[model samples]
Target: MKTPLTLLGLVLLTAASCSHESLTRPAPPPGDSAERGRELARRLIIVDGHIDVPYRLQEKLSPEGEPTEDISQRTAGGDFDYPRAVEGGLDVPFMSIYIPAELQKTAGASKALADSLIDMVEKLARTSPDKFALARSVDEARRNTSEGKVSFAMGIENGSALEDSVANVAHFQKRGVRYITLTHSADNLLGDSSYAEGAHRWNGLSPLGKQVVAEMNRVGIMVDVSHLSDATIRQVLETSQQPVIASHSSCRHFTPGFERNLSDELIRAIAAKGGVVMISFGSGFLLQAAQDHEKRLREEAMAFIQQQGLTRESPEVRTFIENWLREHPFPRARVEDVADHIDHVVKLVGIDHVGLGSDFDGVGPTLPVGLEDVSRYPNLFRVLLERGYGEAELEKLASGNVFRVWRQVEATARP
Candidate 1:
């Protein structure tokens, strides 16, 4: 048996070998061309690690909770819709089944909500069979792509949904959950979250959290480290047998002191583990200025709530919030900013360790200008092309890297 140090050495060696392979690989048949980039986007299997469509849909629906929004068509408001996804050449998108941190306190609420979200995804595919298909594996994604359908992959955005039971991991896997984010806005039984203030229950991961990681590996579920604290991310990198993912994280080097984004060292560590850091497109994640502005807004909002002795649930407070948001709009990040994170990852690691994980619906209207919706993926591809990315490199950025990790995780799982 290899010692932890020996295992880490092997992991680093594997990552270096993969990195070398990507660099030495032959170029595409054609040169780096915009037209070729567009063509390749249409042909390649692009997979986004996180898109909170179900939660967004729930928000957009009527109070009665009926299916008011038809995402199967070209929807007007949100970032993702079927027609837009097809236009953007997005073949596979992991629908983030996000469970809020507060739900962690309840015994079975998170699990129930997760189940409902999965049911919602299944319903979307069932109702839009011509346009959508549920993809449980890379092969299924390929099959659905060949059939001219957009493949939907599910990722549980909070490990709290597992309810401290490792058995629930397999249960969720059976329901098509491909990955699990260790924590959300707050610390859970699993681990500490970057967003949780003064909450460092588990400096990294709790005892059960370690067991959950192993169970996930054994069940072929990718461990997502997004929203985890630096300590938790490092712990996950050390514990997981297969490569894990930062489902929707950005380079913290860009937004210094922002714990939600992965620091340069953590990014390098993840790459050493042979995992890909999927760059998030949220403006807060992309730009320091945006991050600062968001922090100010939250502070002001909290102050206002206290000054007026208003509760968040109060109608007056809601109105105040609405008016305040209207008064101070967030600065818009550009497509170039999103590309910058990708470039940072490439420079720090390599193209083999970077991919897309746009927090589309999850980011509200804070997305960059050109990448406001699913249809804008081609704009990113064009930017990459202009930045000297060839078809091979672009393909790796698009989905090849993530597919490689997914396949490796699947291979390591108990059959």
Candidate 2:
């Protein structure tokens, strides 16, 4: 029989062991936490409908005078790079083959620029086959995810690339162009742009624009209405045989009087047509304060250009503009503001019609504070999760909804 002291010693030893075990064992990940958001982001294949990688690179030519941007390695200057994309769970991202509205003035200029941007993306995939592949369809995107490779999908930001001919639509489709925003910052041959101040050349879709819409429907290219005027959006909805997408648009309710964002009526109409509105992450698109700030900056830039008698394209004007911008930077929107845009869409049309476009690389450094780069997607996911979004809703938001629309566009293409 042991003495009472021996029993007491044994009990203390057991207690110490228990304490040691408790200390050594990993604690359960914080409940409903950022870890959960990261896990969800990883498990879900994130298909960002718009990322302007091509246009971003087009402005910077290499010593060889080529726009050969090597994003296969971690890049310091842009919101997107291979490592950051993987970190953020971006499986497929649409590279915008953006043709600026000014390029539309010259015959065949838009088409030429579009072709070059497409070549840039193809070269990226060709050079970095180990890390990137081309995804021409939703199925291809899924295959890319399964193979653990990042996918490049192409989108045209201006329909002027069609060059006043409907056949160019099918030609671009052959080049892997998946969607085309009808117009950009200004009115073009296709239609009036939302930002075309006092230029409602075609109050809605031009007669040619209508034909372009039908041809896009026949060719299975998603019609992107993000930059179209309100009248144009309504016309596209009435004309297209299939669903359309606003590849990088936000809710106008949040930034009232901002024509770039879709109105509540447009949101409902898009949902009615079984389409999705991929929210843009640009600060100006998500908040009125940011929009107001941007307008003030634009005015300041114009005044400077006029005062200096310098053309807008002058290098000196650009330098002056950069200096002015540095002196008066726009206020950054918060991740909460992005959540509010998502929430507004959900409340207006429910979850199936919402997705993320982010406008990544295209939006510059003006992105919201916490949601600044590709690696920060989990931050948005956490915000949504905290707001009571479940796994299913997040899955749709990540890729499923956009995939469904892509498949539908494919299945229902008239030609």
Candidate 3:
């Protein structure tokens, strides 16, 4: 193993390597990769159901996509930039208004976090009206499409944002938050987080938690099962009269031991109920090997970070972390692997239950390499085309399935 080098040193080396590659004239896309990808992206109404953009706002992340004058820029250095989204043919991105779980436990914290998220949404809308129009409903998404604008749907990443109040659910519903994950990295008032045991007062969606699910269904909010416990997931599925989505989860078949993944049985359950499972793009969440590698890298990086005592989320640190990730580069969890997950769900519950929810900015440095950022989605389209996925199947996998479930869930929620 190589001894750890300074970030400055790594940057110098990578700069040289990049120059060398440019000098060598990198290989062109053989036959039809780029063309097919272009065609595929053009046709599909891509929807990324879970992105951490609102989190980026809180963290003060900048837009990274090129064409500075263009309207569609995404977070700088982070994935899902504007030029790239247009290039990838992504039309609708359900921007996550995520509040960390800790906020729910502390009184007033949820409101504070919610206020920040709302503020960010307003800021985005105010600053980039041409690029992003809020998709308050499926009708609004369609309206945005007709107007040739990007649909910006809002979703609360954790039910903890409801903060033990039934009315808070209504508050978020009014704020255009279309979905809510039951919990996050830590268990909150709702239930146990897949990451941390959040059962401080009550674990796994207390009686209030159950009501939140029903309320979400009643209020036209989609129940997002991305971070819920398996029990919580089952409960949500049982509780919601409409189909629920595992908004940004991968298959346990692809990445085992990550409870964040929906099991084969759970996948079947979601599909049986006519719900969709948007595949996640985080390497750590996709392949155990990749995640394990990054885990060690993080430990090493953190060890270095702690030793140096640098600010964790600073630009210098972020640049350093991004460069570090560029090293252990997780291969495109192969579009085939993505298809395999889609196939797994398709076989289990048919085709109407699969969609793409690449956790672009949310996954941070652990995203799929070729699929890095929103712009790289063209690569997935190319891969899918290469895998012999036809147009009809592609449509369902791209956004049709998710849209279908969304319509149903929305219909059931209407007054």
Candidate 4:
């Protein structure tokens, strides 16, 4: 059988070539508005709803099982680190415990991986108490910020980690996990995935998924709608008593047909229910040109691999991908495009329903130009400021909106 061209495989193939040129730090923003934007970024409590730091570290484990890169200090690769997050004024970054969809095929494998990743996060906080702290609630995260530490709030990217057990929802909640994306690249027992091909398994959410949603609400976990099919999202909205969040999705209005992003109707629905849609910073998530470019590159690269009779994992295929990427350099989106997405959401449903959720370290090299990594958040703020956003509105976009939703989720839970 031909090797399945997995999303993770594609990301690895293009990561090196897709990355922007190295920068010690982003240059200081120019003009009065830029300066004010930078100041506001430092002053506000910025909460990025989704970041893939834990999984990124897990991917770089040494043979001895230790992490190769030290996030406590600046490292060569990846998007997040202590220094960069501090510079960006990022207070709370929800570390994604990303469980691969294929792991669901095995009985306990998914839950096992989730437990291991959770252990890894706990270890990070335990070892670096001064630099990092675990935040299980909005109040705790705010306290961590006051203490000058970056708060690591956890969110499971795929619900396969629940392993067909409704009981696992409460189990993860007790482990500092604040949100759970019900499905990933493939359909699970809970629901259908936006990216899953063929007919949907559950059509919307299975009976087990509805129970999971209810359990999550009762246990103080935010139900994440990102990566789920439209049917699943609607069902979740209906079933969830507390506000839900799309932890890292952009507006689908920009990248049409990209079901991975939220539609205008869906955005309004999420907003009507008092939830927030955290706009993602990936280039493909921001622009139609960038999305088209990515799709074309994948198709061409796959055709070349098959024509050359090379395995996807072969060195020859890797070299071909690098060359192809270099030759057809991806159409990069700018920081302005990111602001446009935020603006689109605000226009459709007001600012209360939108926040930032940069899929850092997860989107490979497909990040936007001015918003390349954790240290570049002020660049986005500068653009928003230029477009006439006041400090109060900017603060709402920064963390206030998501925190409100989170607090409501917490309050809705039964003791």
Give me the candidate number with maximum lDDT. 4
* Per-residue lDDT over 305-387 for candidate 1, one digit per residue giving the tens place of the 0 to 100 score: 68989765556655665576677765677787888888888888989999999988876667788888888888888777767
* lDDT of candidate 3 over 196-268, digit per residue (tens): 6323445456788888888888888888888877777887777778888888998887566767788998998
Ranking of models by TM-score: 4, 2, 1, 3
Which 10 successive residues of model 2 have the least lDDT summed?
A: 12-21
Q: Rank candidates by lDDT, best first.
A: 4, 2, 1, 3
| Local accuracy by lDDT, each model | 0.81, 0.81, 0.70, 0.85
Supply candidate 1's per-residue lDDT for 104: 72
Cα displacement (angstroms), candidate 2, residue 36, comes to: 0.5
lDDT of 2 by residue, 1-415 (tens): 0001111111100000000000112333348658888998888999898898887787788888686557888886888899999999899999988877777779989899899889989989998888999999998989988999999988999898998899999999999998999998788898998877665998999999999999999989999999899999999999998999999999887678988799999999999999999998877677776665656656666777678897666677557656766776666777777777888888888899999999887766667877788888999888777777878888999999999989998887776
Model 4 stretches astray by more than 4 angstroms: 1-31, 308-319
Cα shift from native, residue 381, model 3 (Å):
1.8
Off by over 4 Å in 3: 1-33, 61-76, 197-203, 294-332
By TM-score, the best candidate is 4
- Candidate 1: which stretches are off by over 4 Å? 1-34, 61-65
Worst 10 residues of 3 by lDDT: 13-22
Give the C-alpha lDDT of model 2: 0.81
Give per-residue CA lDDT, model 4, range 113-189, as digits (tens).
89999999999999999999999999999999999999999999899999989999989999999999998888999
What TM-score would every model get versus the actual structure?
0.90, 0.91, 0.81, 0.92
